[model samples]
Target: MSSINAQRLTVLAGPSGVGKGSVKALIQQHYPWVWLSVSATTRSPRPGETDGVDYHFVSHERFEEMIAAGEFLEWASFSGNLYGTPRGPVERQLEAGLPALLEIDLQGARQVRVSMPEAQLVFLAPPSWEELVRRLTGRGTEDAATIERRLSAAREELTAEPEFDHTIVNVSVEQAATELVELLGSPVKAAH
Candidate 1:
């Protein structure tokens, strides 16, 4: 098989509680060959999150510096925190012909569409709005105010579904991961 180009880069985005992380985890576990871009964030690492693995935790000043230096492919401020994808690593992956996947927010996805028009934007939607509410509240990690803010953002995000090239309803993590991999035009690898 030949190497794929930037056209193979897939951006997975959806509402706050749509199981985007779960689907991403499944892909990472089963498809080891897929290059998933780790985003840089100004938010402090949550419990069990590694610096370079889960996210590239950076200081707010450093993130600003990166933005000023034109290092990020896309960046957005969400819930008072800045998150962005570094451009260099993504470019390197595409240059090497590896199919790269970016799990980002709706704003970041829109930025990617403008910056890299050939990239495929995939929206991972929840089965229903009620289910999405349940998932967000069930987490128990955020306060009530934060939850309300997320729900508001989710409502707006859901309306933007038509903007994406593909929509995968995340009823099941495994199934969603499989659909995402297929959309990337990469052969699914057997689960290890």
Candidate 2:
């Protein structure tokens, strides 16, 4: 496409275990200027993940309060837990002429599409469904039950790839990130 503006709100929504964190981390490391929106979640933290940095780990009550207050740009329940993007940070970043990035789930993405029609939706895909299953099982942090649930969720998310403006297949994290950077620059305007 079109060239993306510096203030575009870019969303990365895809199947879990498709290495989004890895790709996003690499992007941040290489391009520290990008505004990455940390999500607010009711899920417990995984090992090595911080409370506010990885996510704004909130009590279920706090999450509900935020939801009721309309603080989130979009919120969704995933795998029996809730996750949302706070409205303030992303708006401030966009206003400040920064490229704001939100790495969220598909339901949340759909919400953003409705609420912020200018936001550009990008879906990251694995090379294959088999590879996706392998990656999910390989994480090894989640128990079999949790892993299965995530995989099931992944299937649902993958079905919505066509809903996104573009998709990047994640074979190599660095290359994928580079391509993402290119895609981000190709569209000049924010999109629904």
By TM-score, who's the top model here?
1
Show model 1 residue runs off by greater than 4 Å.
1-7, 187-192
lDDT by residue (tens digit), candidate 2, 24-86: 999888776666899999999999999878999998999999989989999988768898999
Residue-wise lDDT of candidate 1 within 1-192, one digit each (tens)?
233343467899999999998999989998887889999999999999999999999999999999999999999997699999999999898887778999998999999998898888899999999999999999999999999999999999999999998899998999999888877765434524
lDDT of the structure predicted as candidate 1: 0.90
Q: What do the candidate models score in CA lDDT, each in turn?
A: 0.90, 0.86
Q: List the residue pairs that clash in candidate 2.
A: 2-186, 2-187, 2-188, 3-186, 3-187, 3-188, 4-187, 4-188
**CA error at residue 1 for candidate 2, angstroms:** 1.4
